[model samples]
Target: MSAWIEMISDEDADADLRAALDLARTPHGTVDNVMRVHSLRPNTMRGHVVLYRAALHDAANTLPTWLQETISSYVSLLNDCGYSLANHWKNARHLIGDDARADAIWAALEARAPERVFAGAELALMRYAEKLTLEPGRMVAADVQALKAAGLDDGAILEANQIVGYFNYVNRCLNGLGVSTAGDIVGYYAENEAE
Candidate 1:
């Protein structure tokens, strides 16, 4: 366990974390440790969670929940946000049901994303996320057009941007504060019972 992590009791958080804990349906019980820590900044964390749910509900955003989680894992890896990575890595494992592939996807993406099965639109979206993260100002109309050409509707594009932007926000908060991971939330992704 890293020194920066702090667990929030149900009593400590506002309705936001409480709501998220219920929505996430964490396998064991309670919120993820990252959320627990973010419970310290309840308003900000709640806003992100609300946006994340909205992003998923938008019909144009075709990526499945697990795929979105995978994308988030990739971004967390790029940003070197350990707390984010730990949370999303567990999400990818549980949601995608292939931890090895989850690991491989990131490796493949880093090596050369387009070279893998995720070429074309997916690659474009990932590249767009990188640019938005590393150089937001550099993004031009052409990038959005490329995404449109790749078959993303405006709504999907908007949702993708929102999700990516939110993760960037998360990365900054965790990385800036030097947040670290503890084992408390790892059980959130423990194997579901109905398998």
Candidate 2:
């Protein structure tokens, strides 16, 4: 853990911060360590959590929950954030059910992923995410063209890009802040390891 951040000071929370925390507690079982630290600045943490949850709920792409989690793992791999990787990896198994597919997706992502899992449309979205996350400046007219070739309309592309960007942003924040990976999620992955 980074020496810079201390866990949130329970005794020192202001009224608004407490409210934000109260709101946060309804969904998350407990105040996560990362959330606890962020609770020191509750409003910001509230906004971040709200937006993240909303992004997950947004119905933009046709990818299944498990597949989305797979994409998230790929993003986490590139970002090198254990927090993001652990949660999404667990989600992939829990929501997607097919452990084989999750492992396959990870393998493909680590390798440059030639096969398209969702559809041509989702392929374009994943490719766009890879480009945006790995080499934003290198993205060019050709990238958009490829998405078009895969039959994604402008609206779907926009949503996909937003989701990718959002995850990338959170990955960076968590990485920089030294948030610990969830131990239960870590155990879940270990339990579900591919044979």
Candidate 3:
């Protein structure tokens, strides 16, 4: 599907936007449709990249990278965002170490039955992600309590909630804008296979 907004092309970018676009390139050596969509407002895109890096890549984060990827992928799947789902799932596979397990975790998340594949604090976090995504209004202190009961300290719980919130916002942006996943899926899987 074509994006609702005109994706900014390198040829069309101004000097400032070109610099932002340069910073937005994926490891696969191309700008993502998400970034291209946001490129219409380069300053917003710059702030977005900063927030994204901090939420998912800050060195001070205590949550495991794989768990962060899992939360992201789970949130994407819950929102049925094909773009984010494919990309995050690919990253989760790289971190989780087995294709079947990665697929199973995704399936379990989709089924809302993570017990089939996850346990302990991981399961708690996934459950929290689900509740927060599907029913943010209904979420109460009890939800946070569950994460704590599962052994997540306050900081870890905060990080998990932020990741969940971030993905929910991003998923809506991509899905609402009809961001295409066409090239991304193929490129991501090919790169994964090479790795």
Candidate 4:
């Protein structure tokens, strides 16, 4: 853990932070460093928890959870945030339920060539995520039009956009905070959304 970060211990948490912390805890009763960093402002922690479930784990998502994790992992890779990459990659693999296929997809992503595992709208979404993460200022309407041209409806496009945006946000937060990767939490989005 970075010396700069003053993460609140569970014993020291106040009612407000404790409430947000409880909501963000994993099924295994652990809270990720990514969320723990928001201890100083518990509302942001609560917002982060809500957005996390809504954007990536909700049953209403038009984009599949596996794809959301893949997008998250890919964006994490682009941002050089190993914490998010490792965490979300595990979810992606579990949701995929085929390590071989998941490995191939991850390998392709690591090589910065998602084209090997995706085509059409899926491929377009990966490319868009790469561009959005690497060069957000350059994004324009044409980028979104390309997704539509590739076959994603507005709802799906919105989901993909939110996934990319969310990863970018969390990735920056994790990386910027200098969070330690030791004993990092996994299976964050593994539980069924119906739960």
Best-performing candidate as measured by lDDT: 4
- Candidate models: Cα lDDT each: 0.68, 0.69, 0.85, 0.86
Q: What's model 1's overall lDDT? A: 0.68
lDDT of 2 by residue, 1-195 (tens): 222476554467788877776766523245555456587677777987777666655665554565566667777778887877777777776776667876666677778773645568667777788889999999999998898899877875665666677789988877787778542234244354553
Candidate 4 residue lDDT tens string, 114-190: 99999998899999999999999999999999999999999998898888999898888887888756654555555
* lDDT winner between candidates 2 and 3: 3
Of candidate 3, the 10-residue stretch with the lowest lDDT total is: 183-192
TM-score, each model? Answer: 0.75, 0.80, 0.90, 0.91
- As for lDDT, the candidate ahead, 1 or 4, is 4
Tell me how many clashing residue pairs each candidate has: 0, 0, 0, 0
Model 1 Cα lDDT, one tens digit per residue, 20-120: 55654345664555455565566656665567567644555667767677667767777888777777767766887776776677677566463474767
Q: Give the TM-score of candidate 4.
A: 0.91
What is the overall TM-score of model 3 with all chains considered together? Answer: 0.90
Candidate 3 differs from the real structure by a C-alpha RMSD in angstroms, to one decimal, of 2.2
Residue 41 in model 3: shift from native, Å?
1.0
Q: For residue 112, give model 2's deviation from the true position in Å.
A: 3.4
Could you tell me the C-alpha RMSD of candidate 1 in Å?
Answer: 3.7
Name the better of 2 and 4 by lDDT.
4
